[model samples]
Target: MNFDYTLAFAKELDQADPLASLRKDFLFPKQNGEQFIYLCGNSLGLQPKAAREVLEQQMANWENLAVEGWFEGEDPWMFYHKELKSLMAPIVGASPLEVCPMNTLTVNLHLLMVSFYKPQPGRFKIIMEAGAFPSDQYAIESQVRFHGYDPKEAIIEVSPRAGEYTLHTEDIIAQIAEHGAEIALVLFGGVNYFTGQWFDMEAITKAGHAAGALVGFDLAHAAGNVPLKLHDWDIDFACWCSYKYQNAGPGGISGIFVHEKHFTDTSLNRFAGWWGYQEAQRFKMEKGFVPEAGADGWQVSCTQVMPMALYHASLKIFEKAGFMETLRIKSETLTAYLIFAVNQVNKELGFEQFKVITPTEAADRGAQVSIIAKDKGKEIFQQLVAHQVLGDWREPNVIRLSPVPLYNSFEDVFKTAELMLKISKEILI
Candidate 1:
């Protein structure tokens, strides 16, 4: 309850943290012999120290066993991804059989669409947010076009009311209700990347189901950033990339979840590959595709062991830190402190020089805070970077600062605010 911005207080909180020891697991970035205040985890997470060892093990297997690494090695390359399901399932609130790690985010999205988006006459539309990531927009548009439907007609995008930066839950629900009957699929980001607004997946899924549509989510920013209940929410399917909050390095392998009820739906269509073939009979080189029941049936190729190993190293840290509960507590306080500090700085500057675009309520948002500098957005952002306060710039004016609970400290948030104050003064003059 007590939010103090003192160095002694921050050190005390760090000492009391159960997950404090987990910080050592990562290789923090340094600048000019000093550690950089990394508030850019939303873009790319810091490297895990254990990641090197894990990847090295795979390198040794590839060296010593050669092609035999697929079957003869200690951890067979063919089944490397199977080891990750148990660790990832709980993170997304899914059954172990309902989840699998394979392919990339956009690739998996297209793959899932093949199975879930069955466009029937008169009811063949896809509903999504208007300001979705460009990749998602492209995927949805391409999918609609591939099905011989005009994207302009088949894609119904929901946008915020005038002069608003974030979408409201009520507005989203109303939009779904208005078009649900004609929509074949309801796909949306679990959290809007730019606004940092966490959508109500359960409510949206329920609305879609009530209107005879399938629901899916792209959880690139939400997967490890917040607690999810995908299975309990009865979400039909979902996909996510692990490079961001999952800390699995750049271009890491992605994951997907399919409800158990859909596992035996023989009518569901998919673009099958050998990897999805039944594991028991796969070696026999069967004539037809007999998919391994559940989400594993979606795998299109053999696992990429190096990225999988990196993911394993990070998942191990999540496991040791008690996953979401421990991290969520710290995330709430850290983000609140950052917002509070930023506001304090703005008041001292004699005018509203900066604004947080993220939701004010912690329950409605995640760890990242997107800020817009009123006068010199880009100039102020560059100054902050020059001061060694690392955040990311998005388009014309926004700067995203993510205070990750796993490694980012209260002091980092304080220092970033101080740097912003100094930068603003220089820019205004």
Candidate 2:
């Protein structure tokens, strides 16, 4: 896996990519009729070319069938999410029955917390990585408060060692061990949004259980970006959004996973709705809540037909691309090449202009490489944007560039680095 920071080398890789054809499936943003090199899939994915048509078909069903669309349309709005759950399960590694497409990411997190984040007596603390996506932090803080505990005292944050950018697995394991007796739940992002660190889920889950705690993850970045084994890892629960790597439309439908072990646990609590009522007797208007057999039981309200339609369209493309394992192969090499090319720019400048804080090891990261651009991070980012090289910038310094395997080419990676090198020479501090 040698890398050369050359346009010809990148084009050669593009020519050999088995997933190269997928680039045609998405419609990229344009600048003066030319396509932009979109590396912002970590923030928002490019739209699929057929997205409009997919929406229209669902729209047509509603137009033609009216209320009957619930049970009469080709996909039957009643159960449209079923096929999507099946397609998504293997991407994150779970049983189809354990996965369900429903509600927004944070909402699902709350719903799941209601059932899994039980705290009592002295064993009431929650352990999580520091600087998690803010929504997760809020969820944990709010949940801890709802149970009448002080957030500062009940929430234990496992921070990186001083001056380090990422958490080591050993440090994470040690923290769990040190607080095992008091931790009620161990929750984390499957991949940290800012640093792009993919945590060791299996070890975390085992450590949590050994300490008599439940475990779960918010897979907002990791779900479609890497190959996961949520069920195999014995994680108690998990959730993810479809917009990023799943390429569902903006604020796309979210999904959740509840392990089979929790399905019949009568003591667990849930915020239930009629949609969660067992399908066979749902319309009977029964009083007592009887949940559908699996993760679908967590649904809080009637499905939003359109977002699920948008997500289903993207899921179909995932099927054509031969799933996440195939995508992971390209993801690893694509990101490694991004790292090499970015470093090569620094090499030519005779200084390290940008420092990649994301883990360089393939297993520790997914598609993203987070970089801190010395003092010009934001300036470098704006220049990259002006040149139609679209990536993401954080508040002060970091830029996140993700070469999505489904659409981004090796040429995209090279040209971005070439532009970065060019911008460095042209821009004055």
Q: What TM-score goes with each of the models? A: 0.98, 0.99
Leading candidate by TM-score: 2
Q: How far off is model 2, as Cα RMSD?
A: 0.9
Estimate, for each residue in 1-429, the C-alpha lDDT of model 2 and write its tens digit.
988778999999999899999889999999877779999998888798778988999889989998999999678999888888899898889989999999999999999999999998989999999999999999999999999999999999999999998998888889989988999999999999999999998999999999999999999999889999999999999999999999888999999999999999989999999999998999999899999999999998998889998888788888999999999999999999999998998988878888999999999999999999886778889989989999999877899999999999999999999999989888743
Candidate 2 global TM-score: 0.99
Q: RMSD for all candidates, in order, please.
A: 1.2, 0.9
Among these predicted structures, which one has the highest lDDT? 2
Q: Once all C-alphas are superposed, what RMSD does model 1 give against the true structure?
A: 1.2
Clashing pairs in 2: none
| lDDT (C-alpha, whole model) for all candidates | 0.89, 0.92
List candidate 2 stretches off by more than 4 Å: none
Least well predicted 10-residue stretch by lDDT in candidate 1: 1-10
Worst 10 residues of 2 by lDDT: 420-429
Clashes of 2: 0
